[model samples]
Target chain A: MTLLSRRHILAAIGAGVAAPSLVRAQSSETLKIGGMLPFSGPASIEGRQIVQGLQFAVAEWNEKGGVLGRKIELVLEDDESNSTKGVTAVRRLIEREKVPFIIGTYASAVAIAASKVAAEYKVPMLSGGSTGAGATDQNTAGDPWFFRSWPDSNAQGDDTAKAIVNKFKKTKVAIIHDNTNYGVTLAEQVTRVVTGVGGQIVSKDGYNAGEQDFSSMLTRLRGLKPDAVYIGGWAGDGANILRQAAEIGLKAQFVGSGSMLSDDFIKLAGSASEGFAVATMFEASTPNPIGKAFAERWRKSHDFDANTFSALGYDSTNIAIEALRRAGKPDGLEVQKMLKDGMKDFPLVQGPAGTTAAFNEKGGVIFPNFIAVIKDGKRRLDV
Target chain B: MDLFLQYVANGVVTGSTYVLVAVGLTLIFGILGVVNFAHGEFYMIGGYVGIVAITMLKLPVLAAIAVVLLAAALVGLVAEAILHKPLKSRDATNSIISSFGLAVALQNAALLVMGPQPQRLNLDVSKIPVLSSLPTDFGPVFLPQQRTLIPLTMVILIGVLYAVLKYTWTGRSLRAMAQHATVARLCGVRVQSVAVVTFMVGSALAGIAGMLMSSIFFVYPVVGNMIALKAFTVVILGGMGNVAGAAVAGLLLGITESLTSAYVANSMRDVVGFVFVILVLLFRPQGLFGKAAERS
Candidate 1:
């Protein structure tokens, strides 16, 4: 199911020597695919995942012969996770690299910035990690050139209520967040879900980012005493809460949004991370064939595998390739048209669908989330 | 009651950090007769150097702390000699202006080497036993290692500073210079050399404070802004150029900040800390521990 990669550095080095002719030939026949992601700074972890995912699919695609008759020549750039840098990376990828299509710039701020550039350039840009609605919809009818692979927070949360009822049967849960808009929105989603399911939110608490203390909040939480606490925050503050909970013996099962499935969270929490369950859009540790293959490949190359962000990138790359194949020409306008037509679950070997991937008008995968729990220092499927 | 205990615990820890920061700022003013505006960047340097020592060089935490101190001390020595000495000898304002420039340069240098995202030591406070001494649950107000260590360090540091200033020949020289630099030079005191050491010691303390802060606080590039500014307030509130004054002021500032953040919104903690300093300054323009005859 996976290729046994040999360390053919000599061959690859030899290929590097002959790269000029390949470049010359590549110029004539290859379709330039640009990629921009946060390769440095705070968001570098997610950036690396996106790069790996894009590389994996691109390798697999080339292995099966290039998209259409032209080889995909990917031009990668680092946005440093800044919106300003994202614009520079996108502009460089567009004007300098002359990429006909692009698959990146993951941060919402970055995605929003790069999409504007893509719209300006009239190049089809698909971002998997950027969940900001503005990435796709700000100028949808007027522009139509910009697109996103992942659904924004609104769509993801719309399904979260049904997910809570059908999946966890969670009745009474507490929602904790960092008081940021992102955190508040996510908590509101769970709150809506819990209430809609005739469940009660026993408590809700919010803390500021970079807060060193959480004792009072946890104490307040102990009194409210819900079945579980859903943390709607990023790795740093959320992990601190988790650590504090373990120390204080606040033993309501900890649950969180997809952010909990990230390696950043796991790295921060360490062994204390055990028994933490999370609703994730994707988990690389799944028992499926795709999961098994990704695990093997990721392990061979690096110590840590792709988290949710990596899966998002992998999904995005395959979507771009399919859209390219469907579009036939390397024309950005044609590909944008194809993307708007809605890809109804084209054979994503790694997706929830065996061969189906579709985004409703909202550009969200109706695919089920892989609920995971940290058991024995590794993620185990809860459902 | 639990929340109260936790807040108290947090206040103590928070107070300790304040003491360290104030001492750094106060020491410079005490010795050089100049406000070292770049003191916060020294704190920033301490964090970056500590991270590089621990993460990049794979040194022990103690080694990281020591390395951060030594590295920052060297930077201070260089700044005093090449930067401060030339400028100060020219006039007071030149050194002051140069120090601000130095701060900007060091911060950008740090930003160039290590990007702007926050860098935690990649080590948890709970992993270190001293920090987790208190039961974990006392809710979130309890000091995890990162929060607890700074206060403990402040105690040890304040003790060391006391010992150095009271007992050591070097501290005597620094004191002599602080009291009367030109007169001390006539009295066979190495005033210039003492000034250099004062800067080094002050910087070393700031660096140590920064390293401790990395664990407790969000160790970001801009952390210098928050801590350095607090140190300034602490120095002014304690008594400008007063070592003993700085210590008392630091503790008071910390408790005030912690209580304020706990009771008021966390964001208002800074505002309240400064408000106290302003109120004190309004009453006593010379500062809380104001001493006449100390000109630099």
Candidate 2:
């Protein structure tokens, strides 16, 4: 009878430990896609929406059999809506989890920070919701590894500014924006567009993201007496500003960026939300077939209506999966090549009817922004 | 002139809320000598309690306020026992670190349970028939019935607190303890009970501020963070333990922020508080209303 020695036993155990990993590498049973989102910080709500959309798309794909004959698995990391946290999360996802592709990040600052890490690792990353101009602009001058499914701040600002000046015909405008990358960049874009269109900007100001008090700012705006007030902030702060504006009797045609296109804004603002116009990509009232299908499916699962965040997340995932299918392997460079070469007239859930997302040379998509106004607490398409 | 008055009105409204939060902080710091970094959690707790009372329990506005007070006081008692009491004999930094940890834990707990959605406590005075018909517009200044309640409530609360501190035997004991804990203990003052009472009162005030402000501003987990910083600034600018100084400083800070936003720039509003604190620390380190530093 043959007996094993101590060295042999140790070697056998080591082999046993290394065998499973080798098998895993060979088989590649599931393709893991990393998602970095702010699940706990100030932008947690948006993160939840984006995750929901991503989950829905993944579930649908799995039902039909995932890409490359393998079931798709999502490994998520919470960025906490912070840039530093975002960098750490992305590094962990790329280095530890070894995910070839990454999707994320609702906050613009986080997206910008995380995308640089993805570029450093040569892993293609797609942003579902971040709209800051810097997110794409910084990448364009570099490796161009980051792709955005959502419209950048410049597109939304330009469209909204045009509507405010030409459609609403309000020449004197006041801009109040949150001091984040998203708000600040959008405000700049709006300023550029408004001035280019010969509209006058009377007052411009920025506030912190979670700032609740806008009484002084509103009063100052009232003194300036701008015909229209453009708010470039998220739903929560926007609602507070609107409520305070109404309380202090600062009456003007209130306009906002796409971030205000959520039910939370209307519910929080209550009657103050009436007649508030915003530039948006996805509205629940859209007649687009893909959007309608997504909305119907989303409503069946969630108690709330589908908004732009979810739509963008769904489109971003589909684009990533499509690129994966084209690549025929879970390889970062190949997938990125497929994305750059193949993504054209890509069907999207966001933007106007018949609008499709296509990446520019800068790896950015410019979807047409539709102006929607809150009439009786419902967002109705205005222009 | 009208614009200036409007700015003042805005500042006063903002200041009243700050006063409510700052007074409680000063009371706790003055009496207990604990920095109480988690003081803001009590405010956040009060806001959540308000949501439960008004929205879920369907209580009236007055009843909701009472509920918030009771809940906050209970929480304060728990915090005193678990967080502050054991660390009472330790160095101040230990307590500060522990309290900071408690703040993070409580914030995460709230986030886990409530799911980070901004909730509004519906205290719409416009819904009441009598108040609805009242003129909301005062010439060029528009004072909504709801906003008018903020300063009025602050005044009433501060007055009652003053009267209680001035007349009651419990107040004398608390004052003695604040003046000198060893002497007060020797003179038959129950330092432990007084400390508990101080926490309860301080936490209750902060909670009430949260409840009142939640009606105007939406209630969320992190809602207390910004206000707590302002309250700290108020505490420092007023002299750390001086209650009256906190009240006046709160108003001054609020007005300064308002005028800064109005005249200088809106982005500069928050910068005004830190700049004032720095200037005050440089010139009058003892604070505007504080006497010469007493060597504890």
Candidate 3:
């Protein structure tokens, strides 16, 4: 009866006008994080593994009451590892979904392309698996908007070089990598390190990704007879190279960049994977208690053992959430700043050694790389 | 000299696999007049079948290959019935579009069932008694005994196929149909039946190639796409409907790739192969074996 009066309606309208922040406050009940990955393409395996990590972390957070008492929702768009698709996916995540935070892009090229879009939109995009140096290079214009949870290619390459020179004692090393940005950059870094450490570089070869035949390369490498062959590529290619190398009796000790640190590689390579050493951020054998707990839970839930990929993905998600909690709100710009300046010593949910995940000025997560070997068909930390 | 010979040996090993894939594609194109973009998916399915047979069913290598061939043949027949047969009478574009759609669908379906991870077929052909007795090395070339078996297997398959096409009624019918479908039908060759046989035979060839290469390459859904593209290149270079031409072209392409990778830069392998194809096409637009009138 009272609302029927014009004066009462006017009074209610006045109250609504006075509480201008009410609409903004109500919309903050759920935090959205966009995910960009090649969920249905050649890189789909990497995408699926990365998502498991993100899903596990997000689920755990939600179970314990998500950050700031709001549920975290992941909005995933398949990039298919194409740069154009990556840009389009990021645009959708930012403009259409309006997600404040995003995590994505196992492939470095996709990460680089998508991060530019996220940067232009002033949204924070974190990559859990991309390690191409250019992914988070401050030399680039859009580096501020991108943060990575994995060590850069240089870190992995340096670790690989050190392992080759110290453990394998291979002064003459051959470098083989895919033609992608990640592969080329890692190969270059490894070459530099191999040369700088008083080691000899035998030959550097490049192969297209997804190429099954490496007989020619293996035969040529066998002729060179390098002390070791360093692979700057993914698990799939690495496994193939190892198999072919064994088939051709290349005899070189096969070493790999961080990308080769996957159960898929060991499984694919079979007996050829024996004694294959790789530099990785997460070694399941020497996982911290937190990592151990995460891996066990991941295995139980996903029915697959967590690899370095899953661990990095879970840690990246944890890092994003930590930054959000530190920001005290889901503002994208604020979260980006907090991720860059505030998360220097933040303890990651997963790390290979005792070190915590720390982002440098370039927003790359810095952690000590450890050497792992596929021994007896299982990846084990060697040192 | 040994290194050069080694490269040649590597080339032959790779060439034989290409021959199998290219011949299958050419045969399908010859009879069905459909490029069958999904031809590669058959190869991928064969790899997966080989994996399952060997790992899950614990079958011997030869037995697993047989299973793969049968599975691939069945897949090809089903695909022809469901996807190709309906559009066979329509404009050629319809068949192309339908085949393309089938390729995408089959690839995604494989991804769904097999997941994105690559699985290796466990075939220790190197350990087989007869294969192991053969020299794994040829001069300076360190070819695996298992790998040597692949070329030999391809030779046997191709010889059997040649004999079938030259001597058998079904093969003759399929070849007649490949030359001219309407004429083939008018001659009471049963074009539809020939189409089925063509698809089966072509798919079996691809399946064998997949089984042989799966160990070397590892099996994933997208694996077939690359091999299929290479096969297309072979098909074009050899003449779309020319099976023998495809075999020759496939070997040529493989050897070119290998020699380029060995003597030049490894990255130049595909480039050289494609460039050679373009050169050949420019000189012979109807393809190496296709009739000049067929160019119309």
Model 1 CAPRI quality: incorrect
Each model's fraction of native contacts: 0.08, 0.71, 0.71
Task: Give the candidates in order of lDDT, highest first.
Answer: 2, 3, 1
Whole-model alpha-carbon lDDT for candidate 3: 0.79
- Taken over the whole model, the C-alpha lDDT of each candidate is 0.69, 0.82, 0.79
**Residue-wise C-alpha lDDT for candidate 3, range A296-338, written one tens digit per residue:** 7776767667777788778888888888999998888988888
Q: Candidate 1's residue-wise lDDT over B85-203, tens digit each?
A: 77766777887788877777676566556754456666545545556565444464544566666777888888998899889988887888887788888989877788788788888
Estimate, for each residue in A260-336, the C-alpha lDDT of model 2 and write its tens digit.
87787788899999999988778777877878888898888779888888888888888898888888888888888
**Which portions of model 3 miss their true places by more than 4 Å?**
A1-29, A138-143, A287-306, A349-358, B82-84, B126-133, B138-141, B289-296
True contacts kept of 2: 0.71
lDDT winner between 2 and 3, please give it. 2
| Model 3: chain B TM-score relative to the native chain B | 0.95
Give the Cα-based TM-score of candidate 3 against the true structure. 0.89
Model 3 CA lDDT for position A61: 82
